[model samples]
Target chain A: MAVSFSRRIRSLAPVLVLLALCLVIASTNSNFLSVSNLIRLLSAAAIPLVLVMGATFVILMGSIDLSVEGVVALAAVAASMLVANDFTSLDLGFVALPAAMLLGGLLGLANGLLHVRLAIPSFMTTLGIGFACVGVATAILGGFTVRISDRTFRELTLGRLFDVPYSVWVAGLCVLVAWIIQERTRIGRWVYAIGTDEHTARQVGVPVERTRILVFALAGVFYGLGGAMSASQLGQGHALLSQGRLFTTITAVVVGGTALSGGVGSVLNSVVGVLVVIVLANGMVLMGIEPFVQQGVQGLLIILAVSLALDRSRLAVVK
Target chain B: METFREYLPPVVLVLLVLAVGAIEPGFLAVDNLLTVTADTMTLFLMASGATFVIMMGGIDLSIQGVASMTSCIVAALLPELGFAAVPVALFAGAASGLLCGIVSTRLRIPSFIASLAISGIVTTVAYWASDTRSVLIAAGDRDSFLAWAVGDTGPLQNEILVGLVALLLLGLLLNGTPFGRYVRAIGSQERAVVASGIPVERVKILAFTLSGLMAGLAGVVMAGRLGSGSPTLANEFLLPAIACIIVGGTAITGGVGSIFRTFIGALTIAVVRIGMTFVGVSVFAQQIVFGLILVLAVAITMDRSKVTTVK
Candidate 1:
């Protein structure tokens, strides 16, 4: 009983911190607890939440995807140009959404292929791919923002179901899908197996390469969906739409107790972590902290969280 | 013929130069060559610093932030402290690097994560120091340094000369010193080095500190060239610097590269960049081509057998 209890406490540590932070913020600014402020916070977290879900998969495999900003930029621009937009005559309407997701998947597949087939490090593969994606985005944009005119798309953010935004609903669906994948799937189990010991997993007949490709491709699709949602929310497709999501999402995944060395943590842990980060960001803004100081505070908190949550036993060397 | 693998990058670089010269006769001109070498100095220095870290099986992502913070400090203090701000900026960068080293070594965090956080911290500090504006050094305050930096001594640009001196010094440190041997051993096998009782942690920290010092020097040079500084000044150097290291035939797995190779690699990148300009490739297309080249370079140079699992 005590062993289980200790295990439970270790797992719940991030959640406990999240609650404590919220309580402190609420005490300082009572409006923080109000429904409107809460909704606003949820909406702000919507895109980052989706990004965290995608990042969680790659992180689970002990590899990382630094291509988020690039994929997001390309998908957002391409989707904008394809849908009812000022730049091109092509009007794919809602179909543009899936097409954008496909673009992201293709790029993700490229990343996977480079890592598995060419034996390139995921860090270099994703980083290079990201640069290529940004170039594609720039090429597609042609130095102009394409104003999105699709009414249904615009409603992705403005529309509400019982007072909650569509973006929130979209994020919820992503979270549900991610949770299901994490808890109930063969691929999910294989991910942890591969991360824990790739050599042993390979010896045991695990499909390491195929699983890596699939997860990266799936993550890419999610990033695409995120880019589309962001474009719709802003009513335009800008190539630089996902400027800062890479660091933010990675920080979220790590802070949620996902060891960088891999083979531990879950989507649920990441969700709690995402909420904590988003809440802290929102709260800092509410408290009138300077934007620069807020960034400093966020950086300090990331170092603290990672230091506290790091499983040093797993990392023989913290390279 | 394993030596053939060592010669591949240089051979490719020469062929590329020949191709560019055929396409644009101006690319091979003496004046253009000098300009290219000078422009590549900053990248060479940054990559030279990174070679040490990568050789130790660690990576540094905080160069951009450290450079920016250094630039900000130099710009803000130059008017008051005059030439004295140079060391201050260098110290600021080294201090940030030391902090990163402590976090990653003592606290046992990954260098990438620790450096990334330090970058954010320094950037915030930079913004506060500069008040979110570009700080300009008056012409009177900066002209002497600028003259020395941008001016040519005979045929060689001062920048090129500074870079050459840095190249030799760093090469000597990496090749001749006991610290360099320890770094290489750590990269190849940490357990072996630890068992050897070589003070692995201190050497690792020193490598990061060297990287930070070089980045600070780059910042100082950039400030001299631009006559101004902003928190975002060094934001664009991160990718190019890493690309230089990889393209220079340094293995991302570590223990298999040198500062000399990075020097050649920097020249290769600069040649390509300038050659692209001569060919009138669109800036966006150039980025695409650069990305492709980076991917290809890593694929060619990486020791596949050394990396059992590419996580």
Candidate 2:
């Protein structure tokens, strides 16, 4: 009974932290709870929220995907250039969205293949792929931002449905899809099994390699969608469109109670984690903290969160 | 296969040199070759230190951040402390590495995550210290104290000479010392070493500290050459340095590498970059090539038998 009770407390820790943080910030600044500010906060979180949702799957398998920034940058640039843009004669209209996502899936497929086939560590493979993707994006960009002129595409960012941006709705849809995959699918269960114990999973016929590759491809799709949303929000896309997002998204997923060790945490946890991170950033700005200091604080927060969420007993060594 | 893998780096280096020389004869000229060597010094310094940690089956991603932070420290303190600032910066760099080592080992966090977080924090410190701008070292101080960095010694540039000396000393340290053997042993098989009652944690920490010191040295040299420092000054070095280690035929799986190999790797990278320019490849496209090369090298040199599961 005590073990189950303590486990319940541990599971609820992230929620409690989010609640406590909100109360503290709200008490310090009453405007923090205002509906307008809350909406702004959600909008600010939309892109990262989508990103975190994708990253959670990779992390759930105990493998990391550092290719988020690169995938997003490439997808964004591809989407912008394909649409009615200032740079080129090409205008694919609504087709640009799926096209961009397909590009991301291809890149993610490459990332998965390299890691699984070559047996390179996921971090190194993903990091290298990320760099390559960024380079490709830069090459395509030619040192220019492709501005989107299509009103319908821009509506993803500007138009509101029931007082929420379309981007947020997209993010909500991602959460719902991800939750369904996690709770209702065999691949989701296979991912947890592989992360929990690869040898055992392999023994039990979990199709480790295929599942790993598929998860990476799935992650790429979400990153592609995120890129499109970002391009819509900013009205332009460039090689640096998703700069600094690698750290932010990874931090969000890890802080949301997902262990870097894998096989723990959920889509809902990551969603709440995204909210926590965004609110923390917003609260820091309201408190007048320097931007540089805020980065340092986030850094410390990552270390603290990872240490707290780590499952030491599962490992014979912590490499 | 073992023998071929061992000889691959030097063979590749020679091939690259010949290929580049074939494409552009001027690439072989003494002056241009000297310039390439000089350009490789900073990367060589950073990668050599990282080689030690990599040999131990751990990695130090914070080297670039430490280099940038120390560069900021050197630039910020030059006005007040003059030559004294260099050591202080180096010490601070080592201290940061120490912190990373402590966090990873003591707290049981993975080295990559710990180093990444620490790098972010120190990079922030660098920004805060330099007021988020490039801090320039005064010309008077540069000529007086930093002259050794830019001045030529006989035929070779001072920076090249410094790099060579670092290569020699670090090579000796790794090959001649027990700590060096322990690093390899730990990397090759940590569980066995731990059971054998070796002080694995202490050695790991020392290796990290040494890596940090070398990064600091690289930063000081960079500041001396450029006469300025900023948080982002060494930002571009990270990938190239990692590329150097892997390309030089060092196993990313840990163990089975040397500082001299990293030096060769650094030269290979510099030559590749210069060669790309000679062949009319756009500067932006070079990174894509390097990324591809990095993956290829790791694939070639990885020790598959060591890791039971690749995560």
Top-lDDT structure, candidate number: 2
Q: Each candidate's DockQ score against the native complex? A: 0.66, 0.69
> Per-residue CA lDDT of candidate 2, range A150-215, in tens?
889999877999998888888888899999999999998998898888999999899999999999
Stretches > 4 Å off in candidate 2? none
Name the TM-score of chain A in model 1: 0.95
Computed on alpha carbons, the lDDT of every model, listed in order, comes to 0.85, 0.88
Tell me the tens digit of each residue's lDDT in model 1 across A251-277. 788878787777888988888888888
Candidate 2, residue A38: how far the Cα is off, in Å: 0.6
Query: For model 2, what is the error of residue B72's alpha carbon versus the real structure, in angstroms, after optimal superposition?
Result: 2.4
Q: TM-score of chain B, per candidate?
A: 0.96, 0.98
User: C-alpha displacement of A1 in model 1, angstroms?
Assistant: 6.8
Q: Output the worst ten-in-a-row residue range by lDDT, candidate 1 chain A.
A: A293-302
lDDT at position B44, candidate 2: 93
